[model samples]
Target chain A: MNNNPYYGPEGHGPYEMIDIGDLLLEDGGTIPNCKLAVATHGALNAAKDNAILVPTWYSGTSKIMEQVYIGAGRALDPAKYFIIVVNQIGSGLSTSPHNTGGAMTGPNFPKVRIGDDVRAQHRLLTENFGLKSLALVVGGSMGAQQTYEWAVRYPDFVKRAAPIAGTAKNTEHDFLFAETLNEAITTDPGFREGRYGSPADVAAGLKRQAKLWTVMGWSTDFFRANRHKALGFESVQAFIDTFMTGYFAPMDPNNLLSMAWKWQRGDVSRNAGGDLAAALGRIKAKTFVMPISHDMFFPPADCEAEQRLIPGSEFRPLASIDGHLGLFGTDPQMLAQLDANLSELLATRVN
Target chain B: MNNNPYYGPEGHGPYEMIDIGDLLLEDGGTIPNCKLAVATHGALNAAKDNAILVPTWYSGTSKIMEQVYIGAGRALDPAKYFIIVVNQIGSGLSTSPHNTGGAMTGPNFPKVRIGDDVRAQHRLLTENFGLKSLALVVGGSMGAQQTYEWAVRYPDFVKRAAPIAGTAKNTEHDFLFAETLNEAITTDPGFREGRYGSPADVAAGLKRQAKLWTVMGWSTDFFRANRHKALGFESVQAFIDTFMTGYFAPMDPNNLLSMAWKWQRGDVSRNAGGDLAAALGRIKAKTFVMPISHDMFFPPADCEAEQRLIPGSEFRPLASIDGHLGLFGTDPQMLAQLDANLSELLATRVN
Candidate 1:
């Protein structure tokens, strides 16, 4: 119903909303009348063992996950597994900062953590769907953070897990990078401390944020090799103006800030009193710690460090010059590699 | 003198100025009342063969170059050679946007290029010092850009050249990165299109820029290893607030923008009718193209590609986790390696 095309049923296609009521956030905030936006494909079996959960990433929704990852013949085959793509809490499709009413609207929205997203989604699967265990839990970036949280928080619930292009614990470097993005929005005079009448009011800040992404989101070689031309960008500036801006502009700024705050503090270690290895040790699910080569956000080294802590987890790297943004499925080669790896993981036997 | 502590003779030590009025810039604009801030050490031998030129990098002055690189018995030994550190145009100590008054002051300052800085320094050395040739022309980062320009533009003038942690032609990625820095300054409401009352007026924008530097300026390992603690910062935020902000806050925004514009378009290729290989091949000096191992700004690959085109030039990679900021001389180990390589480069006979 909002002007933002990327929000609501208009952008996300047909989806169901589950009102989870008042949800207590990990950061001591509350999301009153909290609802989960979910899109499902295929069918659940009598035992519900065929169910697979795929969470949305930052600035992404269930529709993008379905389009880019889920398919009839792909590793995330809807024909075999009942796929559920759940929009995270602050994503505009859900009961988010933009969509919420009264005191908890826009900049006044309560801070929700990654744990909060997991708990909300946990309710949807258990209470609404009557699902006891999931066949696999796969996600990329912020979605991957949720996938890791799911495996660690509720070990027996997730049989298999693949967290792609993400780390279990966000690095200090990434926290600072997110701060730049936040400052880029809040510093705009028109933003008025996020009370802007329209998203366009903070256009300068949003554009500046997009410029920072030009350097960090993609591998240096991607720009060096002129890969933007392959994506139909005549030049880098065209890529920035047309592609990056187009992707971010339609989304609500408050929704992005909410997601970014959660992304910056993404850590499963809190579940085990800040002992990352101890937290990861609790995971019984067969895990594939998939990191994209040249990913600046969560580099292979960062992901591999956490992967080593997860007992029996494989450190799989996807090759893409798109870096952390390889999750967007820009490079067909990287997607194909990801599909092959996921297929192998899904086929493996797990308790 | 300006209130900015980083500006004027107070911050840069006692330096001499040579007025070379109305210098025409490479971009067809002219720097009215052009002056070069210079500091010298040792004496130019009767033959003037022991003279070395060390140009200032971006946000750098002659004093910094002296304190970090030059010493009594170091590779840049002032006692053994006549060392001239010429502060680049737009660098505050020289005639810059902050210090210059009238029509071409502040944001109205003319566009400068790497070629303009080289030309200005060339005038200082040739006209004022009566130098026939230089023993060596060496610099790091933006200073490296000028070093490359000096070697390419005045082949016979520089006998030996070392361009460290920089490319001859700026990359598309770097151009966009510079744009982000520029926008960080301009987007602030207090900036008022570069008519800000003081540098403090753009504090928010500059702090945002410092956050961007926190991600890109240093290597990922530097943060992962908690190297900030070694530098007396208890936390990353403390390092950013205390060190990064303190470094940039004292400087004028317009001066940064002016230098950044020059840095973004740093192309010696323009000299050879847009043929980078041809331009680099024009270097007659014994060249050493050195890149820091983890320098995201100008990666080793970028520098090596250009170095390969320069005949007789060695591609030397300095090991440093400080990355692009290795030019700041933070790591003693990196400084030692740099000093050793420079010593060898200076000792080699070049006719």
Candidate 2:
């Protein structure tokens, strides 16, 4: 295993670029050359037998997942296990619509699904690292959707899986939030059919999208406790200004819109014959379904419901007031519980 | 007392209009020529000692209060008590900047407070109705603010007071919500500095203001459970369109902006030396403070805190999930509770 740093300041990451030379499509059309990024870490010497797969969330890159990698005592600890993290398509750090050799730029990007993301990751693992997944696949939120897809798409590859803070099916309320954000972006006058436009104008739409997030991302109790102090202004205007100023301070407006669109179209069961129950049942991996208790978007109820549908799946719930952001907040008690359970699972090697 | 229906469609009920010719102000100015609509039900002669003063909430009129008066077994049941409902100034049905013989319009209107509202009600009771004392002053929400102000300003004129779902002083959160709504109105280009360039344009601003209310007026759970059916639209866009259509259909934009401005400036103790606790302590009326448990704007904690400061005051929290709307939703149960307590107090009237 190499300890070389993956991500450099500007662009270079865990996944090295690979050129897919021009090929003939199924429709008898010539397809342009494309390059994909593939990143691998941990014990590749043991081949696929010691590998664990990690998929990226919306706008996240494989390098971002490096934060979760550990040398020992952690879920993705490299001391005893190999961890493979992949950047999903459409993410700027990977093979995205923005940099697809003029084929999928702007509004021309093809709609991709969780299955497509898992399929691409599987190819990278098998073709580049010579890994046939043997250990576990773990992810949270949208990443969890990819994890679930991996279990179903390659049942023989994944021995165990942990999908946290995600649902097999998106609820109506989830659709509303996602759709609203999508509209806020696309409806901007400068969107120009998703083509060239002022990045600053696009930033305004992103700010509006972020405002909805600031409201829904936290629990009501959290907002009630810290709104005035957090924003440093008494009125809602202050809250809006503070939120917009902080969220867009470090991110590109185009990148924000791209990620928001991906989130809006995210639906695991959309391609699973619209039968989430059947899809979960097909997962041969021993699954640990853990959900954050107070997650406004994907609550414990969703995971509990999924657990009941998947045979032999263990259900664990992490209690935190941080809502969907609990995975990022890393509550001590929640992390300890997760660490203990994951360590025991890996130690026992029950497959 | 005479029974005459004041405003609204003719012959609906009894309403009496009181004209206050002129009141000299301490600041060497004349108070706006004021007219009030008073609605009375039941025999004031038989239950003259049992008469209760009920003030309307912001934007509410005598017509709306009539529902509370006639509600079965309510605190102001016309069958047993003489209920005198007074419309607060600035409401369209009463003396307002909109219809004060064109005296004060748009930006020319004076900033009025709860004390001013209570004072006007006091004049109507004393000079027009020939009443020296009220058995009780009952109100909810903004109406409750006026009721509390009456107790502080005219302690000797009121015996007992019930202020529901209201705070003795506005909290920062309350100001934030009100300020946001006001900004949503005034910032709209159509507002044109309180005077719209076009009536239709002003109406659009009102519709936008109302949209914010529709969202904040209810709890998140309520919207999630009812948005589909209540909005009568399948898609999110359709739902928002339906909502905006209904909201803007009947409201005058100017009226909405003016009312929101009034609400923004609604500080009951603004004149009380800026000391909220001291202002509350000045109230001499025996007070029954009932804040709705789930009222987001005026939570039970606010009323409970105020109750601790007021002498001879009792806190009775209305346990309901309707939030600020609990003033109307807390029907039979709230009515029964108030009746049981007020009946006991009325039976032992001091006069």
Candidate 3:
């Protein structure tokens, strides 16, 4: 690992900061200058032969991903593997609408596809670290989408890949949820067409959106078990009050809108010449597709459909009631399954 | 059997009207004095000793309740029982904000409770049809709440009661949903604080409320299965278009808001001494509490909790994903179960 001190807080870590201005698309496009913050662990000098790539999900950062790097009996144990986690572009902590240097901010931020995120991360790996190929690539949800993109966009770079709780193509149901969230944000008069509006207007819209999400993203059984503890107040008003004061209370309305817009346009097929099946078929990586059965956003059927397109791709369905949240909540079980399957594939890496 | 024209269409056809000036609570109250649209099937002359009283859910009427009266070889049947379907007060077809005397239009309409609804139905049964007591009281959803009220408020008048997909007390979750719908309506600028506004404003608010209901009142599995067939449009806009057009395509905004308000304030114990359990225990009628297992609004757990309080009360959970709608979804298995249970209960009824 590089003993770089300037990458993060003083005396904090060994992660490096890499600027990828060389990978920008021309015309001062909104997606240009996709500078990234990268972190490496285990053995960085063996990048070409021993490197594993990890991409962050929405709102995730290198610091958060580092937690999975060095734990005992963990999937990515530092004692056994070299892990490189790259922060995705537009994830606020990285190159995002908030700090795009007069480029894309507010409503002018251009739409970004999953390809753009992976392409930028790829450039950071090859150009900065001299990593020509990866031993493995693993991610969950949007992270999974990026992992799939790495296999498709740079087939020779990835030997084995795991995509958890996600699909190769965005479904119509996914679009509907994204649209509803966007409508909740943009329709609020306080949004001022994605510009200036009252803080109260922004808060109200955020609270409303959060409430919708809490209902759809959680199991009714979970709610029945945890409602009283989660919200100490016994009345419905108290529940709303607790939700507004706790979860949506601190989030910026503009940030919420921007993130929702990004999520809505998240599809690798959008960049794959509009043929999702053909794109999945091109992935040469030994792929493992893990789907959560009760996921409200992306059901296991979506993953099964995608698996059918990728020859030899292994599909695993998790029978957890955590829904989409199982990707995070039950990570230990998922990681165990992933490690057992990928160990054999990694041992057979061509590089 | 009383062959009175007042018992069927001859009594209250789709277009038939009868003056209700004397039934007005008070001049200039929120509720207007409107016609009582009464419709009965089975035997009217024997109604005093054998009538089965049925009420309607929100946005429903006597026309809708008439279908349930033909209870598939169950407790309620035209061949064996007299059925009197009463249009709940405040429903547009009955005394309501829309057509009460000119004094009770729009915002002027007073909020009515389940007790008020039962009282109005009682007056219609005894004064108009000369009925002294009902052999059974039956209803579903909000109508079921009225059925429960019939047993508590007029204990001696109702011999048997069937409350389907309902509970003795509304939970915080139930109120949370109702409150959200109310906020959706009141927040629409066009709602004009429940006064006159643009047709578009009223329509938008009503549509928003309906959308929320569609999400909460059905399981995610149901949406996954039927969203396409129900909406016909593949995109989100198409779904919204179909939903808005179909929801208020034939209804008045004032009537919709008024009925929603009634549902929001629905509480069997609101005026029954603030103790729903005690009120339920006081019910003299033999009660059957039927709840739909997958109902997100009034879940079976709520009804099961209530069953513990009522002596001799039986609890049956309907295993349907129809949520609050299992009352209309004719599952033959559910009907057969209902038949066996009710046959035993009705055989014990005394005139």
Task: Estimate the TM-score of every prediction.
Answer: 0.97, 0.72, 0.76
The TM-score of chain B in candidate 2 is 0.83
Return the interface RMSD of model 2. 5.0
lDDT by residue (tens digit), candidate 1, A1-351: 224656768778789988988899888878887899889999999877999999999998898898899997899998898999999998998888888878888988999999999999999899889999999999999999999999999999999999998888899988888888888887877888778877888787787777777778997889888889998999998999999987777667888899999999999999999999999999999999999998888888889889999998998899888898877888999999999999999999988
What would the per-residue lDDT of candidate 3 be over residues B78-134, giving only the tens digit for each residue? Answer: 777887777776666676655544555666677666667776777777777787788
User: A1-351 in candidate 2: lDDT tens per residue?
Assistant: 111122232543646675444433222334244345656676665444888877777545676567654446676778767777766665655555455546556466555556556666666677767776668888877788877778777778888888888766656556555554454455455666666444455665555555545444544444446543543666555665774445443343444455555555555565477887777788888888888876767767657877887778888887766567556534556777767667756665555
Residue ranges of candidate 1 with Cα displaced over 4 Å: A1-3, B1-5
> Residue A286 error for model 1, in Å?
1.6
- What is candidate 2's CAPRI-style docking category based on DockQ? incorrect
RMSD of each: 1.6, 7.1, 7.1
Q: Which of the numbered candidates is closest to the native, going by highest DockQ?
A: 1
Ranking by TM-score: 1, 3, 2
Q: What is the TM-score of chain A in candidate 2?
A: 0.83
Ranking by lDDT: 1, 3, 2
Candidate numbers sorted by DockQ from highest down: 1, 3, 2
Give model 2's DockQ, 2 decimals.
Answer: 0.14
State the DockQ of every prediction. 0.80, 0.14, 0.19
Deviation from native of the Cα of residue A252 in model 3, angstroms: 4.1
Local error of candidate 2 at A27, Å? 18
